[model samples]
Target: MNVLVTGGAGYIGAHVVRVLAQHGHTPIILDDLRSASYERIGDFQHEHVALEDTSKVMAVFQKYQPEAIVHLAGSISVRESVQTPEKYWANNLGAGMSLLLACARFPVRIFLFSSSAAVYGNAVETPIRENAILEPTSPYGSSKLAFEHTLHRSAQALGMCSIALRYFNAAGAHTAWGVGEQHDSEEHLIPKVIRALLTAQPVQVYGNDYPTPDGTCIRDYIHVVDLAEAHVLTLENEYLGNQHNFNVGTGEGYSVLEIISAIATRLSVTPQITFLSRRPGDPPRLIADPSALLSHVGWKPVHSSLQEIVNSAVEWELVRC
Candidate 1:
């Protein structure tokens, strides 16, 4: 499969590109290197094209004529989105619109979206379902959800098959492939803790006084490799029709303190931790049902255990250092 991977140079996109290559598919990367690091892209065949650049995007499409498009390009920061909403709206929604329009006009058939769990911000329930109310609190999440809605309508209009895989915490690295998480500004917990722990710095635990048993906020951490596998399965499946949505998670929740403890145990170091006030718009607990993905998509998480996740991240961080 000749696939056009938007944001194929970034953290998650790199992992997905690696997975696609391992699965015997050619990934023609399209990344502007705006927030992406070139060192992380390694030897993947890619083009310097922004998502909103229709001419450049069309040129890449003409070159590859990709059978599928794994759309991973976008601005992805809840806090940053809150601070600069116009940036989020432009990059996330606007760039996505460009690709969707191209697909509608071009020969591209399949579109796999990298959606977010932030779409269900401050959920009313613990284990969020596919049918759960989508009340995104931040512009980032809203932008992703808005693109999904457009994807549905555009798929019907273009006669293309689209799937939006709503990801939870996509942590860890491709330990075997040696391509792991590498961000210009580290925000995800696993990498942040790994960097801090290695440097003998204290990691701040935000608001450990929540209602949960550990009093810290709980989140569903999905291994990057597992997420890549889900994309491979869904994208390769020949039964996709108009549109589909799946919440990609392990159906497990780990609190902030638990993650710290796991990192401490895995790395054999006493982590220096500091508790701070909770960041607003953060849910106390957010787990996934994930039943729809298994039954419908024939997929389930195989590398999402907390110990394995922490271990992979620690290994990648150690190797990079």
Candidate 2:
């Protein structure tokens, strides 16, 4: 099948692109290379274009005639979203609307969206279920939720189906491939810690005043490989409902300090750390239940242990350094 992967040159998108290729599917990647590095895509068939470009996006659609689209493009930072909400709206919701229109015009079948747990905001419970209220705190999350609605309406109008995977932190690297987490600003907790350790800098823990244990935020961290596998399996699901949404995670919550401890244990070195003030829009805890995805598609996270997550990330950081 010809699959169109937006932002295929990105961190998680690249891994999904590789997984699709391994499954004997032709992945036609489309990326603007603004926030993502092109080299990480690792020699896949790709086009240098943003999804908002109707002319170019349509051109690729006309050429490849893809069976499905895995949309992973747009802004993905809570901190940055709080600072620059315009970028998040323009890139996330605005771009998503354009992409959905194109997909509807092209008459694509399945549309798999890489949603985020941020859509749930600071949930009232620990393990957030799919039925949780859609109350996003940050503009980044709002943008994603906005696109989810756009995808739903577009898919319904076009007689197609879509799946939005509202997973949590996508940590860890593909140990075999070595193309793991690479962030320009390093806002993510795992990669941020790795880079700080690699550079011999004091690890800055943001928002240590949250109401969680150790005064740090708690999150459901999923391995990038496992996250990629869920995307692959989404293609095989026979959903009776056209609007299928699921939470993809290990069903485990780990605090920020817990992750640091795991990393410190894996690397066998004490990290120089400094606790900083909380960033706006950061939830105290965002843990995914992941039961819906598990029961529906039998998708399970294989390498999502905090120890393994930190271990694989350390290896990738070492290799990157």
Candidate 3:
């Protein structure tokens, strides 16, 4: 199968591309290289073009004639989205609409979107399911939710199948391949902590007085490899519904303090700490109820342990340093 992965040169997308390759599928990468590094994608068939450029996107679709498209391109940072909403709307929602328009022209069978738990906002429920209330607090979340809605409606109209994986806190790395999180402006928690420890800087802990057990925000962290594998499973499952939406997570929650402790234990080094108020739009806790995904695809997260997750991240951090 010919698979086209947008943002294939990115952290999670690169891992997904590699996994698709391992599964005997040829992946043609489409990345703008704005936020991603070309070194990560290596020698994969890459097309350096932005999603907003319809001409370029249409050209790639015409050339590759991909059976499936895993769309991962967009503005991802919640904080950044808040600061620059026009940029977010232009990139996330606008680019999504453009891509869909292009895809509709040269109709691809499958489209796997990289959605987020941020769509759920501050959920009233502990483990958020796909049917939960969606009240996104940030522009980034709203953009993703809007894209999902568009994809859902368009898929039905165009006879295209789509899956939007609402994932949370993608951590860790592919240990065997030496590929891991390598974002430039590194906003995620794990990477920030790793860099802090490496540079002997303070590990800034936001909101140490939350209602959680550790007085900090709690999140459902899933390994990037496991997350990538779920994409592959979505492709293989021909019996999947017309438009499937799954929460790609371990159905487990870990506190910010717990994650820091796990990384500290793995590296055998104490991290410098500094507690502060919670950032705007950050929920107290966001955990996933992956029962629907598990029951549907028999998908079980292999690296559910916090120690293992932190260990993989630490190993990659060492190599990166």
Candidate 4:
């Protein structure tokens, strides 16, 4: 089966591309190389075109004739989205609409989206489910949720099947593939904490007055490898549906202080920290109830342990330095 993965050169996208190849599938990458580095993808078949370039995107669809599409392209920063909402709407929802239009013209069977847990903003419950109310506080989450609706409607109208994996907090790395979470502007907690520790910089901890135990934000973190594997399993199932939203995470929640402590323990370094007010659009706790994914496809987190997550990230940071 030939699969077309947008943003395939990105952190999680690269891992998905590798996993797909290991499963005996042809993985073709479609990336703009704007926020992603081309070196990450190596020699895999790819097209250096943005989704907004409908002509080129259609050309790639015509050329590869992919049976499945794993859409991972778009803006993904919550804080930035809060600052500049137009960018999020244009890239996340706008460019995605173009891809959906192009997919309708092809024989695409399965469409897998990279959604986020932010959709369920400040959930009243601890472990969030797919059926939870979606009241995204940030433009980033709103954009993702809006595109999900578009995908669902488009899939049903065009007789296509789609799955949106609402990822909680994706951490760790796949250094074996020479790729890890190397964002141009790092915002994810794990990498930021590790970088601060390595350089002896004071890492800022947001919101120490939340309703949590330590008064810090809590989240469900999933390793990139495990997250990529879930995408492969979704394709294997070839689920027949308009759009199925699954929480791709471990059923455990970790606080910000807890995560820092775990990373510090693994790297054997004392982290310098500075507590600050909470950033807007950030939920106090965003833990996922991933039972739906497990029951649906027998998927499990094999390499998502906290120790493994921290160790892999530390190794990647060390190698990167």
Candidate 5:
């Protein structure tokens, strides 16, 4: 399958591209290089084209004529989205519109979206299900959900099968493949902890007084390799018609303190910590019930163990240092 992967140079996208290649699928990268790191891209065959450039996007379709599109391009910072929603609305929704229009006009079959678990904001339930309520508190999540509706409409009317994988805390790296998480301003917990370890700095533990076993906020952390494999399995499935949603996770929750301890143990060091007040909208526990993915696409997380995730991330960070 000749697959067009938008944002193919990104942290998750890079892993997805390699996984697709490993499965004998041709992944044609289409990244604007705005937020993507060239080092992570390696030697994959790619085109420097933005989705907002309709002419170039159409040209890409005409050139490769991809059978499927793994749409991963977007601005994905919740904090920044709160400060400037127009940017999210423009890039995530607006540019997404341009791509959807192109998909409608093209002969593309499978449209796999890289959606986030942030769409379910501050849920009152643990192990969130697919049928969980849709109430995104941030503009980032809103943009992703809004685009999902448009994709659903396109699937119903245009006859293209779309699947939205609501990812929960995509961490770790595919260091063996020479691609890992590298953001300009690090936000994810694992990478932040790794950086603190390398620099011998104190990692701020927010809301250590939460109602949990360790008195810290808990979240589901899925390895990037497992997350990428989930994408390939869904794309390869023959299920047709309608837009489907699945939670891509290990269905296990790890508290923030637990994650910090895991990384520190992996690196053989004692972590410096400072407990602080919880951030607004910080949930006590947020985990995914990924049974839907297993039943529908025969997908199950294989490399999402906390130790392996920490080791992979630590190896990649060590290389960077």
Candidate 6:
């Protein structure tokens, strides 16, 4: 299958592109390189196009004529989204509209969207199910959920088969692929810990007094490779139709302290720590019920263990250093 992966130069998108290539499929990347590095994307064929530009997007779709598309391009910072809702609304929602319009014009078959667990703000249930109420506390989550709603409506009317994988805390990196997470102003916990360890800087622990084990917030951390494989599997299935949503996670939770300890152990270095108050809109615990994905697609997370996730991240950070 010929695939067009938006944001393919990103941390997760690069891994998805590699997974498609490993499965004997050709993937053309469309990335603006606004917050990604081409070095991580390696040797894949790519086009420099912004999702906001419909003409450029249309040209890429026309040129590639991809059988499927994996959309992962968006501004994905919850804190920043709170500060500037317009940016999230414009980029996440507006860019998604442009992409869907281009797809409608070009007539693509499969669309695999990179949705988020943020749609289920402060889950009322232990392991968040697909049926959980979507009350996004941040504009980032709202933007993603809005796009998902549009996708469902479009699929019904346009005969487009789409799948929105609402994933939780994406962490870790490709074990052997050498493509790992690299954000300009790194905000993700795991990456931040790795940077602190490498630079011998203080690891800022946000909201250490949350009501959870070890007095810190807990979240589901899925490996990049595992998440990438889910995308490939969703696209490979010929029976995919209309619109479907799945939570791609390990169905387990790890606390912030646990993650810090794991990173410290893996790197054989103790991290300087400073506790701070909880950030606004941060849920205490957010886990997923991946049973739906397993039953529907036979997809199970492989590298979900905390040790494995931290190990991979430590290795990648060492390489970067």
Cα TM-score per model: 0.97, 0.96, 0.97, 0.98, 0.97, 0.97
Candidate that scores best on lDDT: 4
Query: What Cα-based lDDT does every candidate model obtain?
Result: 0.87, 0.86, 0.88, 0.91, 0.89, 0.89
Top-scoring candidate (TM-score): 4
Write down the lDDT that model 2 would get: 0.86
Segments in model 1 whose C-alpha atoms lie over 4 Å from true places: none
Instruction: List the candidate 2 regions with Cα displacement exceeding 4 Å.
Output: none
> For model 3, how does the per-residue alpha-carbon lDDT over 174-242 read when each residue is reduced to its tens digit?
767868998878899998897887778889998988889889999999999889999988887788888
Candidate 6 per-residue C-alpha lDDT over 176-290 given as tens digits, one digit per residue, 9 for 90 to 100 = 8888888888899999998898889999888978888788999999999999999998888887556789999999999988988888888789888999888999999999999
Tens digits of per-residue lDDT for model 2 on 1-321?
899999888899989999999999899899989988767777788899977788888888889999989999878888889989999999888877767777767888899998999899878987889888999999999989988988888799888888898878999998677588887777788988877776778888887788887899888999999999999888866664688889998888898888887887777779988988887777888888898888888889998988888888998888875
Candidate 5, residue 296: how far the Cα is off, in Å: 0.6
Off by over 4 Å in 3: none
**lDDT winner between candidates 2 and 3:** 3
Q: Per-residue lDDT for 270 in model 5?
A: 93
| Residue 240, model 6, lDDT | 57
lDDT of 4 at 23: 94
Write the number of the candidate with greater lDDT, choosing between 1 and 5. 5
Candidate 3: global Cα-lDDT? 0.88
lDDT of 4 by residue, 256-283 (tens): 9999999889878888889988887678
Clashing pairs in 3: none
lDDT of 1 by residue, 1-321 (tens): 998889888888888898899899998889999987777677889898888888778777777888999999999889999999999999888888878767865777789999999999888897999889999999999999999998888887888898899999998887667678877787888888878888889999889889999899999999998898899888888876668889999899999888988898887889989888989888899998888888877988888899889988998988874
Whole-model lDDT, model 1:
0.87
